[model samples]
Target: MTQADDLADEERRLRQLRLVVDITAQILAEDRHLTLCEALRLIEAARTTAGRLFPGRQDTFDLVVRPRLERIVLERFGIVSTAPVN
Candidate 1:
């Protein structure tokens, strides 16, 4: 659309990104004993909240945060998924 509209959208997306990062950091800090299932649930809740708060911001959060978080989870817990080790 117009330049002003584009700028507003960018600003809104940035604000949502910051919120998501802050929430994730808090969750990661507080939930040291989380199981894999619990970690997945936390990620899902973060995604849901991001979508509900910003509607079309899911893509932004997913693109920016999901991969990094996945890496952190894997590294922190030494998680390695293999196919039955057969």
Candidate 2:
């Protein structure tokens, strides 16, 4: 991919992460804490395209949504990126 393509891809990833941050924040706003089951439930409740197809499968939640939510939570609390710099 060209430099522009890379930049665009990064931008898209950041946007998606931001959306995850926002939605996860809203869903977890009530107690500011959640049990593992609670977190899974929240992800299952999402109305995204994948959610509609896959429903509440724990495997889907773990493989996809959970990591994004974890990253956003970490990012919000001033933990520097664990992702290695390119």
Clash pairs, candidate 2, are none
Tens digits of per-residue lDDT for model 1 on 1-83? 99999899879876876777677766664677877777777777778877876787789878877766766667667888552
lDDT of each: 0.73, 0.58
Candidate 1, residue 66: CA error in Å? 1.0
The 10-residue segment of model 2 with minimum total lDDT is: 46-55
How many Å off is the CA of 55 in candidate 1? 0.7
Query: After TM-score superposition, what is the CA distance of residue 32 in candidate 1 from its true location, in Å?
Result: 2.9
Show model 1 residue runs off by greater than 4 Å. 1-17, 81-86
Q: What C-alpha lDDT does candidate 2 achieve relative to the native structure? A: 0.58
**Candidate number achieving the greatest lDDT relative to the actual structure:** 1
